[model samples]
Target: MQNEKIINYIKNWLDNYLVKTNLNGFVVGVSGGIDSAVTSTLCAMTKQKVLCVEMPIHQDISQVTRAQQHIAWLKSNYNNVSSVEVDLTPTFDAFKQGLPKTNSKREDLALGNSRARLRMTTLYYLAGLHNYLVVGTGNKVEDFGVGFYTKYGDGGVDLSPIADLMKSEVYSLAQTLNIIDVIQNAEPTDGLFGDSRSDEDQLGASYDELEWAMQYEGNPEELSSRQAEVLKIYKSLNSANQHKMKPIPICSIPSEFK
Candidate 1:
């Protein structure tokens, strides 16, 4: 992809959207990942006031460091870029404590999702206070192909500048935008779990493999065992998370009843 052309297109799109909506500025949560870094950079390029928030809930120290680095980079490079660090650990802890005790993996997954929702809530709060639109950091593969994001959580946003770009495309933009080296080199993670598991660890495949599986349509029998396994995982994840990707099914009333 032509980086310059794409960048200009997105910047123009953001400008037009903000004008149409009459919003003041943009609010984005910086996660220290390539996706967030790229999104924030694009927003900053607009030369409009952009608030980059870092909401960490028992997050890994390294991840927090990377986030700070990216925030510093934004402040230094863009005059309109500002940042704030909100520690959500106490809020998360209270929510987790109120729930009934359970050792099931299902509960673990729910808690992980709750962390994302908390961050989402925080972003909206800032947006409300500042009259800005909440910008999301999900790329095409995670947002559509694997449905990797939490519904109503990380997926909750007013605008997603990189939603159409694939993971590889985001990386290309990151490099072009001169994102911080630490963030560009860091492993991709949701940073919601206590163990700090990478996205690949949770998804059972790398972004490259998952992207290929998303677009691949060939004879399964011709694939190697590992490739087939990856395909199976991809298909299962896509199926399970389809609910998050599709619109909610609304029951229509019959014409006679209406």
Candidate 2:
């Protein structure tokens, strides 16, 4: 789809959702990545009240800077756009200190997931206060195919405007929206871990490879070795993270019990 049409569709969807739910506005966590940048921009485009918050939890300065720049750009372009910075470093530190010790990698992974859940909690708190919906920034590959988001964390949201778009498509929309150069050029990171790990670093595959794998048919004989390797990585990730992508399982009681 054309960028303009995509923007209109998302803006209309947000408008319809607010009207349907009787919500006042949207509360989006701007993580200084293209996904968040694009999502926030779309929310701002609706001309509805958009609270674009920067929640940094011991985050890198560059990430914060990029988020601030995007917010500034939004404020300049949209009258309804407002921003606030909430540092969750102290909160995260307290939570980390309370956790039981484990292996470094395992602990780091746990802490990173906790940070996402913490941000989700923060967003819900603000959303409740303002009577706004929590807008998510997850894209198709991360949200569905690979389930890269933290369960009940970034995965917890009232609406996801760009959940249907691929990562490459998000970059395309970001370009069309004239997103800030800093954010557009910034590497995609969850900003939930120390040293600022990129999504590719964590996923073991680039977005492009993941996207290809998501669409590619599994025919080992027809694929190059490198392609097969990417597909293997994609399948492993999808299998491991399937729980996050699927709905919660519930046991159904027999009707005779009634």
Candidate 3:
């Protein structure tokens, strides 16, 4: 994670995609976590406009402080970083009330995913209004290789700055690139529910371990007992999140393909 090369790549990507798309800057959903911090830092380093937004739901406001910390640090560090606040509790509650009463983990996942979608939809709407692109913060530990993000929810973004970097690699790059310490150290969370439950609590294992298992022990043809479990987890994440990576459907060859 050399600082110079990291900065160069980030700048190159920003120029190639964002500049080519005629976007003024990137609008990011900063959750007061490591991934968003690093992603926002990359955008800042690129000398691009960075909109750091705090879109919280019914969860506790503990993360809001971290968002502010990220904002304060960004104000000092980045040239064009700004922030906005959007509380999504009402939208989430409206959707939750429309659903039937089923209080299960699967049901909770659905509700939480709806909230994530709401946040993403809002981000995109703002992106369109501001002539910006939505910048995604999901890292390799969460999206690639292991693939743990919600379909078309948290994974839907105009650009994913850290999609290829693993969890360990993300932290390494963040430290090398001098991201804010508070954000670099904060526990990763979706904040869909109350009190900020952890990804590991829901995933049954930490992100690094899952990535290691995917890289080393995974064998699609024949797996050992432990490897089977890893494969199962990986496949479950991939299958569940497939919609995020899919292209929107169109009518025919001339219309859609062409």
Q: Give the top-scoring candidate (lDDT).
A: 1
Q: Which stretches of model 3 miss by more than 4 angstroms? A: 100-105, 217-232, 239-258
lDDT of 1 by residue, 139-202 (tens): 9999999999989899999999999999999999988998988888888998889767999999
lDDT of 1 at 170: 96
Candidate 1 vs 3: which has more TM-score: 1
RMSD values for the candidates in order, in angstroms, are: 1.0, 1.2, 3.6
The alpha-carbon deviation from the true structure for residue 35 of candidate 3, after best TM-score superposition, in angstroms, is 0.7
TM-scores of the candidates in the order shown: 0.98, 0.97, 0.85
TM-score of 1: 0.98
lDDT of each: 0.92, 0.92, 0.79
Model 3: ten consecutive residues of lowest lDDT = 212-221
Residue 216 of model 2, lDDT score? 94
lDDT of 2 by residue, 155-174 (tens): 99998999999999999999
Clashing residue pairs in candidate 1 are none
| Tens digit per residue, CA lDDT, model 3, 116-211 | 889899899889889999988888777765566767778888878778778888888878878778777777787777677887787866777687
The reply for model 1, stretches above 4 Å from the true place, is: none
